[model samples]
Target: MNIRNEWVSFKIGDIYFPDPQQVAFERHKDDLLDGKVADLSDHGLLKEVFAVVEVEGIEQPVIVPVDRLSGPAPEMSAGEE
Candidate 1:
């Protein structure tokens, strides 16, 4: 999942997951956090979480699904001129 240049960001409905239990039950990691698309998949968009940590001695990017995402995709900010 090389998402270095294919990242997208959006927002999800506030009521999508109203309880912590729902988040825990989900297998994907990104679905449990804020709305930031990291990778696009056949199933859905991958939510991105910026964190610096090692999991089981392997450094990995945290990405989930956009199942709960709502509305249109967010506008991309302008880069430095």
Candidate 2:
């Protein structure tokens, strides 16, 4: 079994939290911007925003920003320098 560490806060390696206020922006948004907030989820954009993965040495799954993840290296073919 893989061992993992228990996180007490958002200060874990490469893991952080968005502004608390932003989390409930719908509640703190300006009246003028009412109904103007773009719902990225509507376009299925939310799926690419974050990735949940089990990292080695981590006790629990981590939610990391998708953009921060590096793509796998391209495979080299025979005779390819």
User: How would you encode candidate 1's per-residue C-alpha lDDT over 1-81 as one tens digit per residue?
Assistant: 778988775344343555655654564555323333444555342354333222233346444334544433234323412
* CA lDDT for candidate 1: 0.42
Best by lDDT: 2
Candidate 2, residue 19: lDDT: 54
Measured with C-alpha atoms, the lDDT of residue 12 in candidate 2 is 29
Clashing pairs in 2: 4-59, 5-59
Q: Tell me how far the alpha carbon of residue 73 in candidate 1 is from the true structure, in angstroms, after superposition.
A: 11
All candidates' TM-scores?
0.21, 0.30
Distance from true position, residue 59, model 2, in Å? 0.4
In model 2, state the lDDT of residue 59: 65
lDDT scores of the candidates, listed in order: 0.42, 0.44
